[model samples]
Target chain A: MTGRLSNKKEKSIIEAARKRFAHYGFSKVTMEEIATDVEMGKASLYYYFTTKERLFQAVIAVEQQEFVREVESILQKNILAAQKLHEYVGKRLRYFQELLNLGTLSVHSFFNIKSVFKKSFNNFEKQELLLLTRILSEGRATKEFNNKLPKETAIVLLHILQGLRLRTLKKIKGQQLDEKSYKNLQKEMTLAIDIFIKGIKR
Target chain B: MTGRLSNKKEKSIIEAARKRFAHYGFSKVTMEEIATDVEMGKASLYYYFTTKERLFQAVIAVEQQEFVREVESILQKNILAAQKLHEYVGKRLRYFQELLNLGTLSVHSFFNIKSVFKKSFNNFEKQELLLLTRILSEGRATKEFNNKLPKETAIVLLHILQGLRLRTLKKIKGQQLDEKSYKNLQKEMTLAIDIFIKGIKR
Candidate 1:
């Protein structure tokens, strides 16, 4: 029972840290602050994760792993390539919205973590690109998509999705985005995707 | 002759300071460091700009004004809205490339400036949004673009452009992008614009 309690405490600490880091960014956040938020001694926090950097990296790793798993599960299900693409885009956007709602999609923190874990981040990005490429390739073979540069198209789609996600978050934070504005964004995204698919169709 | 010489000195100081701030970011740059680069006394540097923050703001302001002017000139030309958008997009992308090459588009510096001049920056953003909305309204009225949410579409386009600029810079630094990759980015931008225009047309 004590071991289980300790494990739960560690999990709570990590959750609090992720929220803090995402809200304040890595450079601005301190271990002691996170420790206080978690209601644990700083030393106890250190015992769980040797350093602030490591702790932040671990948090990001876990998030990325979970994201990849969700995406992979969707992709692995047997479906038409077009339907798979639609699901893929929908899932990614929905996940992004959830993160934004949780205040875990801060651009500053995202870039900070990228710099700190450049190699690992790059590897993760490459894997994402590969998955996208596979989807595009399958779509083309099945005549669900037009033949075009898969990697290039994938990057474009990723950028658009990311852009939409950030804008949605900004709007929610009263940064020139309101409900009406958000709805417009959704419409534009849908149109953009439709146009892209249409342009590339054989 | 004396006024001319002083003007030359001021220009040199601004140029040197711009380079230092761009490379090292505002937090890391020092007045003395900028002075040394321009072979001027630190006191003399102070005569031109009262504080580092002011100097940094001045640097961005000058560039911002020039960028606005260039974009305005492109928009004001008597041409079809489609041609205008094409020029606008191409010119903006090129400007971002030039800024990135000059090391003036660092994410760190952008955030620093954003924090330092939050109100002013917000005002600038609003003005930019207005400009985009005007262009989109014109495009739709002229049947150059499909009728859609101008503001939301503008926000998405702006974000994508910014992301592409950052990604391109990262690639140039031997970090993530390559020549082929950059060409692909350009292609995607072209494709995105084409689809947007097509999707909006009646």
Candidate 2:
């Protein structure tokens, strides 16, 4: 996962695999085909990814990294807690759309790998819940949000986000996300966040 | 779909298919096997369902019937709008658990036949939204709830419900719904309803 040459090779492998897997799906794509596409011998590809599943996991993890980075930056912003909540939720929705478009992950894909990646997914959710809870706590402290149930509220907010993500992804199954769909997706996301803001404001 | 003999035959087929599909998933279960279980000729089975996909939809429809009945009953209740919303959401979560336990339908199964059953599912959701919107509208009329966007709020609530359903269903994927997980699911559902109630109250 480190050193310049090794990193470059791994990145190319993942990039190639993402396209292959997206087009053919995880079950259809083969390790030999990935190696040939990457112009690397089969053995070297195995050196980076022990199996087809591991390669899929690596590709998914790459997607998760971008999400984590975006979330961390939003959490560190010096802004009102309410404003941060809005921004965080918007960014979360956008990334989800991107994820579906890229075919890096979706509800179906997640379900397919649920048992394999349960611990990793749960940890990622807990981290996200922690950040949201912090924002709610800050909002409560500043009297911008009702303080009685910040922790519980954050968790529910995550559930709602998951719901939106699942709903949107369902719409996009076996279809492409287009310009018009983008507008509608944004409109729905904004309305949900507005409702949440209404609910949270003191 | 009526008449005692006709209804009994259809019910038997659905019951047998549900058991087969739940134990082996849609991909593994076959029309011939379902017919054998029902002790009917394979050709006669086709009289009920044109294809395996149609049979799957019928099995899912039976599950949908129970859910629709529950929602209709809740909507007809003489209760405050806020209380009605709480009850509707609680019932929604309970039905979702029942749905997973029945294994008659799932996010994955839905995705698999999304194109085939899109119309039916859309109609079902439209009815659900209409009921929720009516409740929100009544709340606004009585000044018991904020009502700037009744229709949109109802839609978002449905999305959140989908989220909780997806979350709960995801946990039960490739596993059973253990007792502790059920308690946690109930707790989470309660918190989500409390937040929604807070958000809508004037």
Candidate 3:
């Protein structure tokens, strides 16, 4: 019962911190403010999270878990592999946008917390690669795609998509992502995916 | 004649600064060091190029001009559009490697001179887009590729390649690029280009 209660407390702390960080950004949000918002003592909040960066990371971890779960669900659907890949791109892009918003980070600010973000991102990237590999393998097994090297193809595709995401992020610099920028990214991804699918078709 | 001498002096200064910057990186190399290397007084160096950043930009501008010239030469070769693209990728990757070496920049250092670099890169990107469009249009004209939209396809392709380049750059962090990493990037780019060609072919 004590263990469960501690877990609950941790989750609640993360939840409250996420809102604060999202609203005012990582730099602007304070642990004191989060503690006050949670109606907890600052010392108790520290017990749950050693630092603000740690709490932000926990929030990102939760987001990453949710994203992976969604991707898994998409894979489980009985759609064609090409359709699955397309769906993955759309969903992945949305998740990226949300992740950016969650941190409210500028390019300069991103560097400040890059080490923390990178730690979380590396694990998420492994999950993504596994998911993509599975999609390609299933596509090949179904004979919906004829690419001899599914894993290799997946690696290339992921890199291309990442490249696209980085380009869009850089173009926006520190500005809040607007509808036009988001739509342009979607359009580019769609075209890239279309070419990828056609290239892999038998 | 005075104009010609001034231009020659400026070229020599940029040449000297490029070597220093490449060997010692931007942050470490001082204006005095570059001036000493070029046998010009600090005041004289300032008269030609006011800041180290401007001198570095001039060095990059020259590199960019040379890279464009090489690409144009590749385009002039009488070969299949697919072959031209493959050659372009090979040459482009090498140029990217050189650019990385030219600055000796870590990711952190990159941010310091990012505005200056971005100004040069933006112009280079435009030229790259136009060249890619021309390749696609010519391929379509010859019935080697059936894509209806050359410019759009070019945009997507450039974005993907940029994504790949950024990914590789990030992987090395601040470490000098190794042979293995360079080879891995080459392999990935080769696979990506093959798939791209297959996708766009008539």
TM-scores of chain A across candidates: 0.68, 0.78, 0.89
Per-residue lDDT over B118-182 for candidate 3, one digit per residue giving the tens place of the 0 to 100 score: 76678899999998888989999999998899999999988888888878876786666789999
Location of the lowest summed lDDT over 10 successive residues in candidate 2 chain A: A101-110
Candidate 1 CAPRI assessment class: incorrect
Q: Which ranges in model 1 have alpha carbons more than 4 Å from their true place?
A: A1-83, A97-123, A142-144, A163-195, A198-202, B1-48, B101-116, B167-188
Model 3: residues >4 Å from true position, as ranges?
A1-6, A36-39, A104-117, B1-6, B16-47, B104-117
> Which of candidates 2 and 3 reaches a greater DockQ?
3
Better of 2 and 3 by TM-score: 3
**DockQ of all predictions against the true structure, Cα-based:** 0.22, 0.52, 0.77
Residue-level lDDT of model 2, residues B21-44, one tens digit each, is 777767777789999999999999
C-alpha lDDT of all candidate models, in order? 0.66, 0.76, 0.83
The estimated TM-scores of all candidates read: 0.62, 0.72, 0.87
The residue-level lDDT of candidate 3 at A91 comes to: 94
What DockQ class does candidate 2 belong to?
Answer: medium
On DockQ, the candidate that comes out on top is: 3
Candidate 2 Cα deviation (angstroms), residue A174? 4.8
